[model samples]
Target chain A: MSQTSRPRSRSGNLAAEKLTYAAMLTPALLLLAVFVFIPVALVIYGSLFDFGLTSRDWTFVGLGNYVEAFGDDVFWIALRNNLIIVIGSIVLQVGFGTLLAAVLDRGVRLGRTLMRTIIFAPMVISSVAVGLIWLIILDPNVGPLNAVVKGVGLTPPKLGWLGDPSISIWVVLGIAAWQYTGFMMVLILAGLQAVPKDIYQAAALDGATGLRAFWYITLPSIRNILIVAILITTVGGFKVFDLIFVTTGGGPANSTQVLGTYIYLQAFNIGEMGFANAISVVLLLIAVGLGWLQLKTSRKA
Target chain B: MKVLGTACVVSLAALAIGMPAVAADKATVKFWTLKNPGMAEFAAEAIEAFKEKRPDIEVVYEDFPNEAYKTAIQVALNGSEPPDAFYNWVGEDSARLVREGLVMDVSEYGTEPDGFQSILSDGWLSTLQYDGKQYGVPLEAVSKFFYYNTNFFAEHELKVPDSFDGLLQSCRDIRAIDEDIVPMPLGNSERWKLNHFITMLNERVVGHEAANPDYALEADDATLFTNPRYVEALQKVLDLQEAGCFQDAPNATSPELTRTMFATEASPMIYCGSWCAGIFNGEGFEDFKMFRMPEVKGGDGADGTNFLIVQGYQISAKSKYPEETVAWLSHLVSPEMAVRYAETMGRVPSNPASLDSSDQLTESFKWIAKDVSEITVPINVLDVKLENTVSEAYLDGGVELLNGTLTPEQVMEKVRETALKAKAKLDK
Candidate 1:
């Protein structure tokens, strides 16, 4: 009699609880369906057609857009640029950010807060504004930089840093690093703070010292946080657009064009909405795939 | 609970009743324009005039910075609420909008005798037409020309260049005097500015070919980039850079910077459009003059033809009050209005009746007009596809050439490739 009564109560409770949970999550679920899921579904759908701003002249050309994208030289160039930016950020931002964070943690005797604020100030500025400011600073004629170069008693050959396609990539990478290094440093510093000082002391007692202690104790302790920072920077690097658009405009002749700006140009500028969406789908997949790998590797570690 | 429920019901009912009534009583047209020092004032005056004519209609004027105008317009047009009437860059931009049917067919209104100038001659009307129908009313016409600082020229005792050789020699003389001062500040950073140079060369090389009935037919049938004239025109730009005639870091230098340099006499000369006349006027440049860029050697019909680019206004297809918008546009395109616009903006009028010169006009303005009037060939309208493709390649390749990374042939090849792709896409 007792077991039958308990089962009856539990079944009734489960029904009420399910209703309560649905009611609580209804708004969020609706929002996700409208904003996120629907747009992604549309992107996937749109990639199958050859639609533009004008006319519903879409023909269902399965994988045609993808095939064309692969063959397109601009796509390859933009992809190459994206890879360069990703690798550059990882080497410069992550490596320098970690080293800087460790140095700062060791307690520099200088104005640490002031240094930190100065380093982080760029991240606080809008990317567009940052691009413009750099454009002015890098100007050959009126810019003080050239003036300094001339003041050094050398005939300064006017370098179109942004105009020259060969050098534009490096300039853009430099800008990305300048803006993001501080952000990465802050993340690393926070992770460093979370690291237990006792662990380092214990390692020292066990004959671990200097670089050895950092290698065995400090790095392993903060490995998860570094992974998190790396994942964030990698995704951020892939999605860079505003600075590139404002500074170089993917010029002097589409040389500095990134996938994000290239997608924008394809969709809005060229009115190739379907083709642009296909590129976006590819970008999204690459990002997701990379992020998944990072997470898996971190978890295994 | 009853009181709260009652308040919600009342508010919802109020909103429901208020919205349609507000929307119906007065038609509001959102207008976007580039920010200029005096444009807001002009827009305000125009709005007042519009309001006086149509008491029931209201205009919501929004202004954006010049640099942000393109992105802002694109976003605004695609947004939940779009402007009814907006400023647009002419040429490929207008064609894009017209093709999309985003722009309204004001043909019925524009063709009306009193709505717009009936005397819009075949050549004049052709500029605004897309696929045989007018999509917009031509607001202003501008021709690219060489603006020189009169004081600098006088100081250097250099005459205005009338031939290609003379132009090259003058550049060398200017360089010899002061290497720091750029003889011609051709800024390649803004790709369009680079295109200005290319357009001038095209005029010199192709001559009447751009306006030729046979030329368009030929272009439609085959790629225009493969043509000898196209490569010859591109070569002239590369030649100029190699000669060290242009400013250092041409790619990094923007139009604004170039203009500022000219205005301050830092650079002796700048190749810019006649729209810059107002800028010079505003800057109180008392000793600035302009002349036509010299003709290229052995170029066909390379005489007096000046390159004319037009910018205009169009009503959006999605506009709520199409009639009112048409009425406003009609008033703006009238002879009196065109003259006013020309005077204020320092632009040439498309209407024949409004071409009267004023005493306040600069010497360069008169010279350009006289030169254009005497030309046997009409101003060239570049094929939209070839224009963007070649322009971008020239800009990108121009920098590399200047930096010694790419040779002239490579630059031409890159341009040819882009032009071929654009032709293929356009042909489809």
Candidate 2:
């Protein structure tokens, strides 16, 4: 085999190898065409029409759905809520995640595995379970949180945690932070452990140590992982549905409605498939544009 | 030995995998309903009697929870695996299925001798009709009212209020028993609970005939939801809230929890559906009585107008076994099954035949049946009555109304805006 891999023979096998590779890639390409590309094209096409899911008649309005979505106040509220969740998840989840990862990396030695496992346990649970658990905890009537608040001298919100319009979205954000911060921590922790220990040791020979070692050695080393973590958080924030669906259900006059839930409301609950597709297309474009911007900015950096 | 064992396993596995869904001679008819506790059992019993009548037909029963049932039925009807016949509320949901040509016109089947139409009254049969064509069988009607603990009412000397102001006063009188005693614990977290309240209130305040055009989305955009009485109906709900008729955090509490509250006698009153009678009885609390939502003062509604949500089954137009499906539905509304439904499910069956059987009707249900028969004007809940987007707005507006984030007028304004948008969309 080694003798057959001489330069002339290697050059001759290139076309055959290329053919084999094309044959191998055909299934994946077809799968992508069937699942991703075709559905996206259909969604974009459907967004231009006016139709119900069950109605046999489909009227082509040529961007009428997009027009309605833009003029719709609930659509704007949903977009604003999505942005709030993204920024807030990044700050609360990624920010605290970095700190926890750093502490677990070097500062804590005793029961390190135990602490990591405990901190990472919630990540194993589904978001729907997390939402239901927090729903009971934040419930105004029987939830322990309000009992504890009233036990002390403080007062809970008048309309309950998820019921109060002014604070329900923030409460949902906090719940998301609780459930997902552990995941971000584990991701960053993998990056931290991959940072060669000798680099920190060499830095310690100089003036860098403690918080300084973290700021320079740890953060800069895990920069790529941090970018990945932020990207994951942003995408999850935009697609958040189950938690908000189970908890607030975009209620108290839709103060907690995100784009995902609003799209579901338009599609399933209200039976406006075309209008829902328009909102979905808007979500898709925003996601693609932000992802492109992130990649470009990361590459520039 | 190993080869023989493998052959045995494969043959057994093949037998398990290729089992028939029903007897080879029987044609399967799919049935769907909401997942209430007793409904499945009652449906099974009915299917047993149906089997005795038609051994060649098999009924495959399925159910979904209330909210999911709506979406499930809609999507299922459009998909390849549509139900042979599915339970549905009798307003826009069923009518929309009719409009989309998804529901079968059982007019001929219904008009045959011993058909469901012959079994039920003209009014009961007409409730599920569209343009004089019968679309489905009317199984039952559920009405909402103030269900009070009989013992607590007697102890507190509380009378069932006949007027809206009197109801508020009743709330106050019950509150005097204890400040923390949620006089009537409303569970509006799903928003539909309050939607039911607003439905009757609107019926009482705006009158059904006047609000029908707006609800139907036939009124002009400029005049849609322009009735001042709509605001008054909202204010009535607020008035109940101010009177401490509900718990402090009604918008957060669930219907089940609040129903448990009333069942446990922690609360004396609950404005719940007629189905609560069965649930309360199942929970071992049977000392409960019912009364209609009181008429608002100076309102245009008639004396005996009440909330009557008619629900029934419609066959999918695309069902492969339409004859069997129609037979199954007809059997569902049969005299024996109607009695079973009333006895097991504690609802007012459209077919009142055989209700005189022993243990066929609970005392609480008998009152419901009498009131339903005597109802001068029947109004379905607004969520089922209104157009979809407008219904969504009404649901959200109800939550905001309870939250006090929006005043009654503001709530109506939001509803009016949504109605205008829905009307405009319809025109387009």
Candidate 3:
């Protein structure tokens, strides 16, 4: 009788522990299920149906939206623009961020704190605010930049900085670099400080100083942080919407259109829910794939 | 006995939660409108007057910015709690909503003596009609025209263009007189500005009767938007650009900034809406004159055909209190209130009776209303008439054309492709 009761009680205790764990996780799990997981599932499901936001009738067209998106020229243009932004961001944000971090970490001792604050100032400002600031500065008719250009006896471009379609994407890149480089710098700066001082001193004694020391000693130490920064930028580039929205609105003939804005136009402006969802799915896949690749590379490194 | 008592208590609590905790006597009507200058003040003044008539009906008003309002209204209508009535452009947008059974037909209330049918004309009411049923109350009549600086025209000895060729010549002459001045300042960055130009040009080239079927996408697929005249209208926009009528970067300028340029006398002329008269007056630039688009020589367009769009309130089909909603919307468009709308908003009221009632109406506003009334065929703006996707394509095409990135043929090709796809989707 004692042996049978002992085993039963142990099983009962295991069940109670399981119940407690579920109860503890219920709030957070429920929130994720309601807000994030449900919306993602709905998007995936909606991508297969042709419907509008207000349409009472929904027609299931399996893979039709994806096929249409694949054929659409605007989709291709948007994808190309997204890749351009991603590559440009990695080069400018990561490349320049490392340089700034090194300078602040080793070279600039005087007023370092002040310079650091000033460089990092734009990160706290919202993207919409940053876009508006840049818009005013780049205004063709009455902007101060144009006034200065004219004052210096030079003709500003006829279409202004953002008006020219061929160069507008690069202008966006430059503005993004100005805003996000400091964030990357601060992130990298933390990793730089964590590096052991003895490793650098040993490398210097072995004649690996200055640029050589940075390449051999400092870079290898912060490898993980650099990978993290690149991954963040890569993911962020794919999701960029608000800045382009406020500044260009994907205009000057759709020259600045990225995937996010294109999806918005299809969904809200054109009322193509299924097509927009299909585009959203593609965007999600691209972001996820790039992220996975970055993680695998980081692990290999 | 204990279970029964607990059940009774729960039932009572549920009933109490469902009931309004307020006076429970007043009916709240949620009213929504696009944000415009002075609209809040105007709505407040109107609401104050409305309270005198129906103190029991409390109107909860909300305003949305123009860009977001289009999406917000549709999304709100789909939600469980929608506004009792909302503002809408009375064309394809309202027609789509009506077709989807999202708008309530207020015809019964509309026909009452004090309702909009009696206050507004039959033709005006027809603007908001789909399938022979009225779905909206027409509030304002808006039209676009060339707002030129009288001082600049007088200084340059430039006459108003009365023919298509004359308009082009006028542009050349303006550019010749002052190379620095833009002949017609266009803000196509918003795309609707170019749509306005194209809509009038379509009326000029194809005439209203021929353009209507195409505008409605009722024409056969092969012939749908295949008219050479449609391409010709697009060419004319490029012609204006080539003639140096517009600024160098029309595609980059905002409509508000362009309006400021004209009001400050920076630009000599701008094709602006009737509402701009109020803005010009407010900005203290009263020295302005207006003219319609010149006649397209050898085209099918007739005199007195002009661009006219009617905007008004639409009742939600899901409203709990349709009678009160209709009553509130009707009261807003009543003659007394229409006069206030015209006086304060600087728009021509749909109610003709409001015209002579408002002593505060500007001289320019009065003339514009008179001119709009004389138009035999009032063409709906292209953006409002065309399907959403096609309209977007047309808008984008206009930008590309202005930017010199796409030629007339190329723009038409792009428009045709999108129109075909949109028509296919609608058919499905």
Candidate 4:
């Protein structure tokens, strides 16, 4: 009788656990199904047809849109611009962010809190506001930058900051870095704070001092955090639209046309929904691949 | 429990009794327009007038910003609900909507002898027609004119240019007076501003008949956009840039900023739309004078071939109340409302009768309306008339052309490539 009762209680506990887990996961799975998977499925399916924004005509094109985008010069230019932005963001945002985090964590003692707050301020501001403020600062004719340049007995660039096709992208990248480096720094600073203090004592005992200690111990210890920072920057760069849209409008001869803006232009401006969807699918894949890399790296760490 | 159950039954009974009564009493028509400075007041006035005419029909008017209106209208039209009546350009935009079956014909209401067709001319009516079917009612017409600062011209001793060569000479003279001052401030960052110049240039150089084929891309693949004169027209724009007529960074500056420069006398001249008179008036810079674009040298284009764009209202095909929508639209555009439109908006009302009594039509605006009436070739705005793909290419080409990165020939080659692709798609 005791053995039978024990088996019955065990079975009852198992049933309750299974019910709890199922109940907990249903809402999350439903949300993912509704918000993410369904939309993605629609985008992937719709990409195979020639559809317009308002038009009900959906002609079966069978990858025609993708082929068209591949052949399209603007598409190529947008992809190239997106690549530039990704690389620039990694170099500027991650590199400077890590440096700032390190300095705040160990180097500066007097104004660490103030510097951290100031650096993190831009992250709080909306990208659109950032773009507007920068547009005025970069205006060729009336901007204070030009006034200052002239005041210093130097002529500004003939096309101003955002006017030159060759240099406008770099200006945009700089503006992006100005806004995002703080966010990355904050993220990395948290990681640095979580690092064990005993590691530094151990490194000093091993005669690895200052830069050598930072390189061998501090850098390796913050590897996961740096990867996180890079993953964020990479995804953010790919998804960049508002800043570029509000600033240069992907213009000066489509020189600043990135994938995000290009997708918008095709979908809304050009009324090519299928083509935009195809480009968006490619963008989604790149983001997913980057995300997978991040996950794999994090798992290894 | 009995009391609560009884209360619930009473509420359900009340709702059942009241629902149809509310639904039957009024037909609300959704109306959408791009947000402008005085448009809200003007729409309110029209709706007020409309209310007196049709008491049973309630109109809901919503305004969206110009940049967002394109996507808003498209999405609204495609979604479960669409505006009953909406603003649209009378060209490829509305034509595409009409083709998509998103726009109602409204032919009967528009062609009513006592309706909008009676007040508007056949030509204005035809602007909204596609495949011999009317899809819209032309409400207003806009045309480009050169707005020059009177004080600047007086101080510089510059006479109004009457020919293409004279215009270039005027630029040279103005630049020579003060090399620092921009002779003309053109903001092509939006791209449409430069496309305006190309539209007039194409007419001036390629003429209507010759350019029409290239514009329509009806020519053979090898001959598509091969017209040398088209390249020359682009060259003239480059020539103006070389003459220091335009700012160093026209491609980056905004159209609004360009207007401000001309208004503040920082720039001596700015070619803008007739709608700019209202802006100039609002900005308190009324000391500006209007002039048509000067004639192109050795060109077959007719004189006074102005760049005009007609904007109008289209009834959504899915509107539940077509009769009320049409009636409300007719009342909105009636002779009485037209006067109010002119007074409030300072636009050239579609109804010719509005010109007789409008007190708000400034002298400069009056001059534009008169000048537009004299247009022989009737050159429509390029962005409105061209296919979407080709229009984008033209816009980018204008940017590259002004940036001095692409030559006229190169620009035309790009244009040809886009035009060929667009033509193939359109043909299909």
Best of the candidates, DockQ? 4
Better by TM-score, candidate 4 or 2? 4
Task: Score chain A of each prediction against the true chain A by TM-score and list the results.
Answer: 0.91, 0.93, 0.92, 0.95
Q: What total of clashing residue pairs does each candidate reach?
A: 1, 0, 0, 0
RMSD of each: 3.8, 4.3, 2.9, 1.9
Model 1 C-alpha lDDT versus the unseen true structure: 0.75
Query: How many angstroms is residue B92 displaced in model 3 relative to the true structure, after the best TM-score fit?
Result: 1.0
- Candidate 1 residue-wise lDDT, B1-428, digit = tens: 99999999999999999999988988887777778566677677778887877778888888999656876776666566778778875777777778767788767765567666364566666777887887777665667778888888887799899877688788888988987778888766766676667666767876665524322323543554455675677677767776668876777888898888888888788888777867877787858877777887788755557777666677777777776776666666666666666566666666636546455556655665555555555464453323444445656665666666777667767766666665666567
* lDDT minimum window of 10 residues, candidate 1 chain A: A155-164
Reference-based lDDT, residue A74, model 2: 92
Error of 1 at B362 (Å): 5.6
Query: For residues A1-301, could you state the per-residue lDDT of candidate 4 as single tens digits?
Result: 9988998999999999999999999999999999999999999998999989987779999989999999988899999998899999999999999889998998999988899999999999999999999988988878898899999999888886898999999999999999999999998899889889899998899898888977998888889989888888888889999999999999887889999999999999888999999999999999999999989988886
Which of the two candidates, 1 or 4, achieves a greater DockQ against the reference? 4
Clashing pairs in 3: none
Q: State the local distance difference test value for candidate 3.
A: 0.88
Cα displacement (angstroms), candidate 2, residue B289, comes to 1.3
Error of model 1, residue B336, in angstroms: 4.1
Candidates 3 and 4: which is better by lDDT? 3
- TM-score each candidate: 0.89, 0.93, 0.94, 0.96
TM-score of chain A of 1: 0.91
B206-316, model 4: which lDDT tens digit per residue? 887888877767788889889899999998898888888998888778888999998787888899998999888888898889888888889878765778888999999
lDDT of 1 by residue, A153-254 (tens): 866544666766778899889998999899989888888888888887888889998778778877888898888877787888889899999998887667
